[model samples]
Target: MGKHRAYKFRLYPNKEQEMLINKTIGSSRFVFNYFLSLWKEEYKKTGKGLTYNKCATMIPALKKSNEYSWLKEVDSIALQSSVKNLEDSFNRFFKKQNKAPRFKSKKNPNQSYTTKNVSNSIQIQGNRIKLPKLKMAKFANSRDINGSILRATISRKASGKYFVSLLVEEHIQELDKSNNSVGIDLGIKDFAILDDGTVYNNNRYTTKMAKQLAREQRKLSRRYEQAKKDGKKLEDAKNYQKQKIKVARLHEKVANQREDFLNKVSTIIVKNHDVICIEDLNTKGMLRNHNLAKSISDVSWSMFVDKLQYKADWYGKQIVKIDRWYPSSQICSSCGVNSGKKTLDIRNWTCECGVEHDRDINASKNIKNEGLRQIQSYDKIG
Candidate 1:
């Protein structure tokens, strides 16, 4: 069972060291985009695709001749890994069997680089990490990465904090048949309502930190105004950076809380259940409606689903996604009657056959029944 996993470590750095980390990230991104453009141009002109090795070989020569000669300060192997990753991305996008490759934009310019030989003595101490380039820096191990490291990503979030992610390979053992099975209906108000009548209340992770975030943001905005008034817009004021880090730390705290909660919930579910059934939600499309947008984003149903999926796969449990069009919530679980006209405001209702139901619980039950039916059908066919 070849599986992929990653372990994360929290990095702590002095101001100077932090700057170095930022520079490394920027240089890596530059190297990737630069090589990507060069390869793309060559392919357009000569009608020949560049392999990863060929693309990587061109980097040293280009860096010596370009404005980014500073990239030489970092590990050359890390830079090569970035080019190789770009090549992989292009291969996926331009495969004859796949759709056409699309253009890259600055707003979405690919970020992060990788390094092989990741399995060689990578450990977390109190507040530092031992990387190939930086030797030993300040970082703390956040989670146990269950797999061997394959790559690492360095990127900044919207809150302007730098983070490094380790990608790894994890293999899991098969699950036994006697484990539990469950169906879950996700909701903004309830978080998750299981078929077993268990209701996990929404913690509203973002909302809980809204006050502190707004306060820091206010400080940042005031610093920005002062900087503009001083006519030094190119360089943000010292106060601006102070406020920025404050805001980033707050956002990081919120994210940490959310991740912790999700991990606990996912771990519990995975441990108890052999098969998990969930709705195939169109979260992106659903986010378009402004009315429930805040609540929806706060819950992060998409992230929840993704965590459930890979974890389920790792645990050798089945995660079945009912079709997006499937009317799980609209159908009465007792008699299979369609509650087609049900609205979001309808929390509880009685079926035509006189069965009382809590809307989410009923939906979860219907989902479980349908999932079982499908599994049985598949088994019969097999």
Candidate 2:
């Protein structure tokens, strides 16, 4: 099967390139917001939203207008891509895949613009990438881009770092078939508990950086207050801007740590296991618990599961998602006895069959058995 992948690399733009990038980002945002407003009015009158082609048709007229003549200063493809994005957002909303589209805000720290490859307009050289207006920008070409480039998205993060992500089409070889299988139980106390009694501890990246983040945030708040008292806008305050960047950098650090941890754990699990079993957790519902919410979010179980899913697909592995309603923790993995419900405080329990069960380990074992059973049933049906 053909596969699509993205190669993201850090970019170092020169002063002129940076200015052009900023201009394109602003133009893209303006185009999206402007067309979005028009789309809403059109939908109100016709009971149908504007499609991508319809939105793209307005770009030329918009550029010719006196008020929007500045739109011609940026790459035309970038503006069209923005309209495409807006249309995609609306389509997803109509299909109930996501919430309704909202207007892009200029105050948003993170900004991005997408442009497609046309007549080799986008290409990678020795240590740089060539984009439409911003000719040759230096990037850390850590690895070779091995596939046909479909499109590129250039983004500026809150930490003021620029990155370019290239979406490419490529063919990948599937991994050899294996008999190895494992079940995993995800939790806050332990990031993962395997059926074989192996445990991966949660790193609590956010918790570790919380103290420093709070300090920086407090300083930023103080700066904002001083700026307001001096009759200055928060954006115009140099001290406030500096503190904001500091806070953003700290948050970025925490995110990087968490991502690194998840990527390593997921890779190991997918590479080692052929059939992986995990619970289909209702993360949104779980987040409702104010007491455990911070700890739960810190563990990032959803991200781990997502990574596992994609890696499994990439490597010809299988992921079995047992229903969330399964009482894996309460059941006896040895004798298949449904012991009465237990509270979170109970870590271990002895079954009537004389089996000593650790809560998480028992859960993992049960998950494995149930998953294998489900797979076998599917095989029989087939």
Assess the local accuracy of residue 48 in candidate 1 as a C-alpha lDDT between 0 and 100.
Answer: 78
lDDT of 1 by residue, 244-345 (tens): 768877877887888888888987888789889999999979999999888888888888888998888887789888888888878889899895778889
Per-residue alpha-carbon lDDT of candidate 2 for residues 1-382, written as tens digits (9 for 90 to 100): 5688788899999988888888999999998889899999999999988889988998999889999899888999999999989988998899999999999997898999999999999999999899988888999999887778989999998888899999988786778766789999998899999999999998999998888888889988889989999999887898998888889988888888999999999988888889999999999999999999999999988999999998898888999999999999989999999988999999999999999999999999999999999999999999
Q: Which model scores highest in TM-score?
A: 2
Which clashing pairs does model 1 show?
3-170, 5-168, 127-138, 127-139, 128-137, 128-138, 128-139
Q: Rate the local accuracy (lDDT) of all candidates.
A: 0.77, 0.92
Please estimate how well model 2 matches the true structure, expressed as its whole-model Cα lDDT.
Answer: 0.92
Best by lDDT: 2
Q: What TM-scores do the predictions have?
A: 0.86, 0.97
lDDT of model number 1 = 0.77
- Candidate 2: list runs displaced more than 4 Å: none
